[model samples]
Target: MTADLTVVHARTLTLDDALPEVEAVLVGGGRVLMAGSREAVRGAAPGARVLDHRDVLLTPGLSEAHIHLVTYGFSLSQVGLHGARSVSEVQARVAHRVLNTPAGTWIRGGGFLLSELGLGEYPSAALLDEVSPHHPVMLYSRDLHMAWVNSAALRAAGVHEGTPDPEGGRVVRPLGCLLENASALVARAIPAPTEAEFLTAARAGAQDLAERGYVSAHTMAFEAPDAPRALQRLAQQGELPLRVWACLPHERLGQAQALGLARTPGGLFQWGGVKFFADGALGSRTAWLHAPGFADGSGTGIPLDPPELIREVGRAAIELGLTPVTHAIGDRANTEVLDAYDALRPQAQARGIRLRIEHAQHLRAEDVPRFRGLTASVQPIHLQADGPMIRSLMPHLESLSYAFRSLRDAGAVLAFGSDAPVAPPEYRANFAAAVTRVDDAGERLAPGEALTELDVLRAHTRGPALAAGWDDEGIIRPGARAAFTLWDRLGGNAQALVF
Candidate 1:
């Protein structure tokens, strides 16, 4: 008998069963043919080419449940301010980029945090100007809610001191920071990438995720419309190595509807969700809060997208068969989103779509159960950097921040991700952080909310698959995809094989 493929002499860690071990697995037609004792497999497919890896542990392929693939790809080439300890360090990097670039070109980079830069206040444009007075420069805070544009960039964008802040955004008084929609002012002035650039970014991002053992990713659309189109191009050209569940930003819903975009299952890449933001992020000091704001007195943070718009668009998303996923980082943001979701519950259920809240990061105890039937697509790795800020800013709610265990107990489906570009999608880092709850400061933030290794694996695998509506993935069993991750251990070294 001719057999398609055989993986023998390996201990399979099938997440489907509670036994914690299986002998081997057989693959055919890009699906799991069988999984059982190695001897049983050899007897069934005697002619198959057997690749033995007895030393390795095999489980289902890991998935990043949330990420911005193209942005992450571009970040690989941009100035990264993620670890810059001071404003001088950020300016130095920007200066270096400016020196190397041609005149009149806009320097685009991001991933700095005022907290990390050790600045009690937003850095002034003067700091960046000292480094690159002639070149237009825009540096985004790590959370992405705010941007610091050098004077040249501000001039290029036509933003002046008298330019009133746009609705749903704020322009810091000193003209150094543009929040939410206002950041688009400077961003619009920057050059849009060519189609080739987009394709390169998509391919690089997909390859990078696959190299890290991610067989699939749920790419949130907090990016330009061209980004997802680039991913689609890659998929069509067969250059995409990872399965992608893409999204359309809420602002483009009207265009998507006009173009007849809807959920497309059973494809290498598909538009499956509508993305919205209820507020900004904690690290950026813009995460919308409740009455008792940040303990450090930054005041209740800024709210971005209104809940009413979420309800209207969310309904449209459900009617069109796309899941609705919102970015809600603070307690108030989460609460407002939940209220909007509750208003759409019946419709969401009727459409067979699971509502998702990306970064469902911090929460009020009372709002915990509101996520009962939703997917909390979260990035545990971020806790490493945000832990101290979380403790200082919202100390009272620190226990519920990244509350993986608590969310699971509250009946929320947890889907793990890296939110890369914001942070890299490193599964090992995620495993350690989620399971250990250790932060950059070496302090354990809400240790009581930590998940077990198994829980982490399950969230990273099966949980994301479910959220993506892929029933035939995230497991080692008959009728499942041949995608598998070979791990040194549950949360250790890993590699992926998607046959």
Candidate 2:
């Protein structure tokens, strides 16, 4: 028998540091069988079909370590506000969507930053009402920390000036914005997408990722439960093209445990982590800081799911063999989560599970080194928008924001992603932001913290695989996943392919 397929005459970047570059690769059983000189491969598999791409550079396939997969797909069909630069721009976009949309239909969109809107002050519901009085509109900020709602939408959710802020969140005074869990009140009012809509969104999200050279993604479950289920369905039907590591929100930990869900190994998809939020995001001024917060006097940011709650639930996750993945974006938030992790470290290590912190953005100096050995599931692309905000709001900690170099130096594993839907999963953007350390305003938050292309590549590939506890997917070597990204240049345009 000729055995399987072979890809010959390609400049394969094996990513095995000791002997990194190779001339060709052979694949079988959906894994890399051999990677070396093309002539050697030809001698071994004389009759194997050849895919000649000697010019293209092949590397391990890119994996998005943190993303809301299905949600990113669904957002494509919903009202989109990603590029709105000003409040007027947001209003205009909402107005445009409302015009074409049916009456009484709910409007939803996200991916805007308060700073980008030039709002020195919190915006009121009145701003959106001007353009959309008849429609109920709710738009989430890029951070997923806050939501902006029009008056009609507020009233539809029965939120009035007297509405009390929910614990761990707030319903802002002006009746326009809802922070953290409060956003859910308004979100609940929107109609859930139908099953067909979900399938469409999943396909859209997966295709978008594939188009960007991603062979796998670790989808953080900020989306509804049905979202991950939809992904699982796709994988079961063999329709999913990318490897998926799905997570459950912490609230569902008990449910998952009851269902006897445990760490699933070896497949196109698996359940590997339980996700939690320790605080909100900086863009929405909800990231919990220590003290002396924004220079402009926005009080220490809002806290979300408490560290204690995370710790309590984290124990259960460990027993179930699921990694504890928490979103911690502020100095205080990071500090608290670290405290909890310190307490759980023993158990986590015993179970051979890794602890992951999403958006380990801002940090207290004393806590920097503590991240060693943990997975810092971060989005370098967000630094472009967050850099200016950190300078203005948390100036004291500016040197530590997105401290990629510091974290990596301290022995932390950095898994980089674009946090798509929140930002496009543009690997080029990630490469640019991580390597250049430039923000949207053209100012470098911390030039010293910038990483080189090689460093960024490791985080985008190796780091994510390590976090998912998959030693076989990120490296292009024998026994490794045959998935790969063929980049024109290390940091340039690329295509993803899986055998």
Candidate 3:
């Protein structure tokens, strides 16, 4: 007996249509050699070593379809304020971090919601200054679409009360917050990490995901150039755990084309899409909406990359055999993106490229059908917190928000992710949010949009694989990759089993 293969005996939920459930899977050479009953598997791979997990549910490995990997890794150490309920609470947390951190160092952190903090207006820089006047601070809102910088940070970035706002972004009055592109004002001032530092962060992020049962992730391109380079280094060094699908910022499309970068799929890191943002986020009240903006008098959110730009660059992306991915949160943004995609759809389909829309968070009744062939890369966990906000801010769109079932029935691929660094890569939260359709306030936001446990599992596994064109990674079958997540209970705690 060679003892070269391993037979994993578990109650398997194979997402494969032919045989949806299997009692055992024989894995070798990082692939599924055979999957069937315990008796059949042992007979096929005689004397193979057994890794028994009959008590746990074994399904295809989990994938975090959207995350800022390196940033999240770095955020592990920053001051966390994810659930602060008041301005005083936020100040206290910042003050606590200042006590331990050296003076004059940048104090960076995020995960706060204005609604949670009962904020009617953006906090003034003075509030943060009250806590850490000596150290420069830049805390992001929960959505990562806004930044709250202290006075010292404002000065460090050369942003004064008189400084004009940058194009397509806003610099709030009283000098505490920056929105959209304006974030670059202070962001450019932050020191860039060395290659070694970048590598450290990349490792931390990837390892964290693997420990939490994710075998793969799709890292969004909303990061610096050093970000992906560090990931590549990690992959080459054989230290990377999660198989990564990377994206290039649309702003760098010219540079990418110049460097001959397109859909280069190999190894652990693969570049497959060009990323764009059609609007801001719902939590930020910056979502680009149609007619009568936010019900709360927040103007029809700030539009980012224009639809014209998406159409132009999207075509070029498709021509290079890459998918064009856009983030659209509001009805108007979705409508505009859908319209732009309509023109680029035929060309994309001709090349076997699929158009993807990230955070298809909101849509009109008429716009739901328009998603028929597009990939909706959405985050279910977001629905948990954004429910109350949706009701209060965009009441008109509440029925259509986070329409998971609607999108699925319309023939759209629903890839789920946590949008980590904004929210933790918490699949349990995703399960609760998507299945219950319950928000933070305990009210059901869109109950009709809810999905079953199996549906969510498929979205987290198979949907992401299809979106990234990694055909062998998401399902559990004879030819599929040998990656599985063992859960004590479905949608509960789990661990990855990878050959």
Highest lDDT scorer: 3
TM-score against truth, every candidate: 0.97, 0.98, 0.99
**When superposed on Cα atoms, how far off is each prediction in RMSD?**
1.4, 1.2, 0.9
What tens digits encode model 2's per-residue C-alpha lDDT throughout 1-499? Answer: 5656766567877768876989988887788888888888888888888988777878889999988999999888877777788988888888889889998888889888888888887799999899888889988888777899999898888888888888887888868989888998888878888988888899899988998889999999988877888888899999998999988998888888889999999888899999998888888888888988867787888877888888899999999999999999989999999999998999999998889999999988899999988999999999998888888788899989999999999989999998878998888888999999988889988899999998988899889999999999889888999899888899899999788
Question: Given candidate 1, what's the lDDT at residue 311?
Answer: 98
TM-score preference between candidates 1 and 3, better one: 3
Per-residue alpha-carbon lDDT of model 1 for 1-499, expressed as tens digits?
4555665568887887754578988888888888888888777788888878888888889999988999889888888887899888887888889889998888888888888889888777878889888999988877778899889999988999899988878888787888888899889888889989988888888899999888999999988888999999888888889999998899898988999988989878998999999998887677889979988787898888899999999999998999999999989999999999999999989888899999988999999988898999999999999998888878898989999998999999899998888888888888899999999999999999999988998999999998988998998888899898888788888898888
TM-score of candidate 1 relative to the true fold: 0.97
Q: Which stretches of candidate 1 lie over 4 Å from their true place?
A: 1-3, 18-20
Clashes of 1: 0
Candidate 2 residue 398 C-alpha distance from true site, Å: 0.8
lDDT of 3 at 69: 94
Candidate 2: worst-modelled 10 consecutive residues by lDDT: 1-10
Q: For model 3, what is the alpha-carbon lDDT of residue 229? A: 94
Residue pairs of candidate 1 with colliding backbone atoms: none
Q: Which segments of model 2 are wrong by more than 4 Å?
A: none
Which lDDT value does model 2 have at 160?
88
Winner of 1 and 2 under TM-score: 2
Q: Evaluate model 3: give its lDDT.
A: 0.93
